[model samples]
Target: MSNFSNVSRRRFVKLAAASSGAVLLKGCLGNPPDTTATTAATVGSAALPAANVGTGETPEVTTIKLGFIPIVESAPLVIAKEKGFFDRYGMTGVEVSKQANWASARDNVVIGSAGGGIDGGQWQMPMPHLITEGIITNGNKVPMYVLAQLNTQGNGIAISGMNRQKGMGLKINDPEYVKGFERNQGRKFKAAHTFPNVNQDFWIRYWFASSGVDPDSDIDLLAVPPAETVQGMRTGTMDAFSTGDPWPYRIVADDIGFMSILTHQMWKFHPEEYLALRADWVDQNPKATKALLKAVMEAQQWCDDPANRQELVQICSGRNYFNVPSEVLTAPYEGKYALGDGKPEVNDFKAGPLYWKDDIGSVSYPYKSHDLWFLTETMRWNFHNGAIQDFDMARNLIDRVNREDLWLEAAKEAGFAAADIPTSTSRGIETFFDGVTFDPENPEAYLASLKIKRA
Candidate 1:
């Protein structure tokens, strides 16, 4: 509805084909092959082999469709399927559908699997909150339950090669230099993210506002597909983009762009994406929800294991997944990056995508406080035109959607150590690389301390 559109190249094709009455073909939407089966014979021929291990508690339903974008953040879901973690936990009919892009994923979740879409899967920050309120779904309220966080880190800001001499690395020392794009270049600084008013949007906005540039007024920001973003950069039309790997890594690898900063460097172990599902689906099939959680939890642990990293890449790079060469994922998987344009390389294992745990706490837990931060950031930009009016409303929305209690139950059932389960819902204060601290309890003070904000 907004100028950004949140539409992807695949969605554009879908629209064009529908208008022209052309039959849409497979791979057009990047939709994976259906894995549902009505009989045991057909079940045996699903995409990934199922172990069908006994979990004692049988799920109400064994089939579910979860949509995901082709990024490293979706690795846990892919690994869970490929490694038989879903089957081991009694969820034998899990279908991890490949979405065309973020917009397609959002639209699909709204319709749900029964409507030929998806139940739910990976999401950007506060998307579950937004969807539950019908803020982004064109007034079709779809109650969603935030089950668990998919991952943290594995995201970066990439700048076009044209801006190589602009000193746009981890920190921008001169805001005026960037602000002068219009005066010298004949246009505003153009930037893009996969979706508007979400994780990637907030990350780039934070970087800009922290550097004294008003993201809304000082530049042109829009939601574009990752491929189009790269093309815009290659043609020197787009200035920068914010998205997760391996898109950012591909930019540097293909010699089109250089990394300006990673989300990890911006805020180490920051909340990235999440796992959520239709609340009705979750409520009707409670046991199945926990089963799904356990499967993803085990997959997260497996992804974090260095021994399985290579195999993780291999599975995710298959034709049904990311569809890239193994080499494209290797560097980012090992926490090694080129970071071109004279920036120092990042080679720390903890610097890449961390699913289960990070230095300060568990990455898998969907802390209510992190949800509050995302809502607060949305408020900071006055996103959704005041969909979230104040802190009290934001807190109420979080209380309704966040399902950390279920995560705890699943962890205990899966035999996770007592120490691994979090006792509190909050992860406490979060600090950014710009020396700004966000106290979840005193979000008002956090907003008051900001120099540039619409709130």
Candidate 2:
């Protein structure tokens, strides 16, 4: 029997009610002044479900172990837990564990919590592809499926104080910027990102290459955790870095660096983070999986609401979560951002997470084209040496069975109409910051156009 089979509905409901009251009371006390294990236990209990809200159907697995890194992009998972969305969907035993980095998160999913690993959680857009390609899992491919996109347009690249002082403003792909970097630093400008072969690497490399700077030769890139990005700048360990919030906002707020550019500025409405799960778990727990998706979709909608921004920030700032100031968390959501180079604050779209959208042809839907782009990038960086010559063969590596169909079912259950559902799974041609357009059908042409690539 699975571990979840032992939990009785009545017993779970009684515990959930008590825990919910404790969570409310704890919130009333300004996010629990006590950080004791007991307080954490109370909060954990509150996160469980009070009743089986499913359609007279029990989940194959009642407990879910979700993994996440402490960043603003992981807000959907956090919000879902805090608002009791998981419990409302009958997933009463959901635990959101904090991962140290992306690599660890990937490993957790590959090795599951029972074998001392995570079941699923918030991950980078390219992670599922990388896993499917057997790059991160030691040649043992773990079938991971993307349930929904967590957010878009929340990531940014920032330059150090030294670089900013040398007239190296937010100019992309400029010879002067490169010269300024070399002149100011007297060496290749050192940069850092959360992980290799991920969105941070892709954006920074794209930005640099677009400006005629060879990321491989012109600059030195390092892997630094998002939490330590600002410190790396202050200590002169790195000249610049690309990552998601609230580190970028924190850099500006701390006066250590200036925002060079946001990811949205490069490719508007680009997919960032995603909620991924192990494919086997998803297959075995169809009802539970649908419930999980429904709860997260609801949370995504809630997070995007303007009125809930402040409360969302407050909730995300807790010691158990992002552990940053509320102001840092608020800037990206409210569209009020400080450039940190003594410039006027700009009110960019700040376009929060697109959970479900009709105008964008299913913004939350995982387009095969998006995965193809990520796969091409992985090959570009020499992370995977698959046959890129055959587009169909390469595209077949992505888990198509669980991609858009699951999200569509969840959306329908969430009260979306047929008109809101996209007719096609592909988002069609996507253009980037450098005026280069990527047609999903012709990814090879797109890959061939890039001047700076290793594949």
RMSD of each: 12.1, 10.1
TM-score of each: 0.88, 0.83
Q: Native-vs-model 2 lDDT? A: 0.70
lDDT of all the models against the reference? Answer: 0.83, 0.70
State the lDDT of candidate 2 residue by residue for 400-434, as single tens digits: 42366676655554444344445555678999867
In candidate 1, what are the lDDT values of residues 51-97, reduced to their tens digit?
Answer: 22234788999899999988999999998888777776668899999
TM-score between model 1 and native: 0.88
Off by over 4 Å in 2: 1-57, 165-170, 176-186, 342-344, 352-361, 385-390, 400-402
- Residue 237 in model 1: lDDT: 98
C-alpha RMSD in Å of predicted model 2 compared with the true structure: 10.1
Query: Model 2 TM-score?
Result: 0.83
